[model samples]
Target: MPLCHLLQFVTSVVSCSPAELKLDNNGKKEKVKGFNVILKDTILFPEGGGQPDDHGTIEDLPVVRVLRQGAEAVHFISSALEEGREVQLKVDWERRFDHMQQHSGQHLITALADKMFGYKTTSWELGRQRSSIELDTASVKPGEMEALEDAVNNRIRDHVPVNVRLLSIDDPDVEKVRSRGLPDDHAGPIRIIDIEGIDTNMCCGTHVSNLSHLQVIKILGTEKGKKNKTNLIFIAGNRVLKYAEKSYNTEKLLTSLLKTGPDEHVDAVDKLQKTVKRLQKSNLTILRDMAVLIAQNFKSQPARGDFFSLHNKDGDNEFMNIIANEIGFQDTIIFLTVGEEKGAGLFLLAGPENVITELGPRVVELLQGKGAGKNGRFQGKANSLAKRAEVEALLQKHSCRRAAGEE
Candidate 1:
């Protein structure tokens, strides 16, 4: 198919066609029959300039990824497109303009940082909801971010006209640009983002042609970055409204839960947490006292050196431990197991080491469980306590055999 590149503004909606279509995974060359389209010429911006690509549609089919391959843009689609077919390329204007605001806002910020604070923006990234710039300085002082934002936002409110122009590498205005020279792989004409009187810089990302298009510039926060650099995280355009809405909703929820205004929510939460700790301590003491009372109730059950205690306590291992400790000190064997219908826990402590060594495995086997121990103290988990009564009888039966030494 014959192909030609479109000469259109960054915001233009393009009419194009598939110059050639084939299955092109990022690296895999398998013949997948879907998920990519290659347009002859498109207004959709590819991934570049610390900014991401635009996602829209080609002939109403969703275009998921727009990648820059040399001078051409490769469009990845959800469905395969036929060669030379008419396709209308549309840019998601809302998202596209969001990128424009952030990308252009970055240029203004980087320019002013160098102008006012001598801090340079070395690199940046455009993210789904947030964007950040890595500064050349070792660290940004706590107080400097406010001043940086103030200056950047002042420029945005001024509504400075922006210009995009193609220049030859030999043009004298090249020296007036910020940062280093053109990229090593510079192709065609050099594109410069000229921000009125604020700054001029080289960038491949699509940006708003006017500064006021960036509704606002807000400094979200900052952090220490790689190699002693500082990163300033920020949002622009409609995201400023979005970030504020989300923050307000969160604050509203916190205030409601704490039964206080936003100003006192933290103190309210602190008091609530302290009160919970006190209640937890009180409950633990009550459970221990209850366990002791339960031991007294079962202390008189008679057997031939055989003791069995079963309780369905929802796998409270600590309660099981307390019961075993209270009654297991006597001169007899004990299988104090607690559990529910699905599973159970066993804590075995016996007066005779040989008796437990022999009987513990059988009890575990009866319940289809797993456990191990020596010196007549064993602990394990079991699949079922349904046979607890049978298992209890087995313990009593084993005690009789062990006492008689009938092996």
Candidate 2:
């Protein structure tokens, strides 16, 4: 037998202290209006099994929250209550009731899927907004999924009583309990949740007393996973109503924006994507034509090797590089403008390799730019056109000195 089964057997027979219900006044004790009780024992498993803790009033002192520290259960309370004082604890019935409904509903669905289709629930996550369960199955056909949903809902409508029992591990029917998995060291008597003639599993989480509490169970979607695994997203009870409301509003907004019905939104978006692509292509063609015209105008100007200019409205960096390569100069000074505005500029000042080696840093400092090359190329943004001229004059003066062989 498993260690947990042995532990469960021992735990069942042993009469331990009634699970200590901590008052939620930050561990501080205070006076209470009406609170008294000596519980023989409790089945409320303080928050565990991916489910949140139970909330309610203990001895009329509102239990804001219940948390487990090690093996002891601590209840966080708003009102101060004396410690060691007996209190009649009352769980938040609505919340606890809802959880019970959802949990039992989950069991019915998982059991039906396993019995009918041989799918096993491998993992599950109960989140605040939604919940999901991963099943160890390759795929679930649409018809099968619909059938499973209908079957689970039918069980809920049947209003089956959900029975909670403490049973010894050595009990004759222990092996008959068809649970997906049980705790490794489960000892003493295990807490078993059984739905008459439908499902039975060992679980420590609180559950609804009856199936009727679970009003509905709706499968939202499914995603394929590794090997033979698939995740199913679902909502239960009031969550189903909330999801429907949100989805309806979203689709209504999309229909208005696309000037089409909710069903036509996808087609509207596809058409919009094609329109954007066509506009981008047309814009590119216009930019290419403008670049050609600018290059022709620059070629008309006389080149003294002192200054080279090309005005571009599109701020095309590729065009600047093309013009620079064509107008080669031993001592070149290139000044390209981004249209008539003060945008970006590139300056290339190169003398013979030998000349630049000595005065490269000095030229960079004078132009308020920084770069390194054996020849010379300095590219950066300029504040204004006047600053460009000052840089050009400085480069021109330096080039003249080099031409005269005066270092």
Q: lDDT of all the models against the reference?
A: 0.74, 0.63
* Residue pair clashes in candidate 1: 36-77
Instruction: Note the clash tally of each candidate.
Output: 1, 24
Cα lDDT tens digits for candidate 2, 57-150:
5556555555554445555554544444444555566566556656766778788988878888886767666777888987887688888888
Residue 329, model 2: Cα distance from true site in angstroms? 14
lDDT of 1 by residue, 1-407 (tens): 10111322222322234343344478666543344455666788888778888877776777767877677777776565556666576668777878888898888888888898899888999888999999998877777889989988888889898888778878888777775555565577778888999898877778787788888999988898999998989898899999999999999999877779999987988999999999988877877787777776778666424465556464356766677677774456767666575455554445467777777788788888888877767777777877877877887776677678764
Q: In order, what is each prediction's RMSD in angstroms? A: 7.9, 11.9
- Which 10-residue window of candidate 2 scores lowest in summed lDDT? 4-13
Query: What's the lDDT for candidate 2?
Result: 0.63
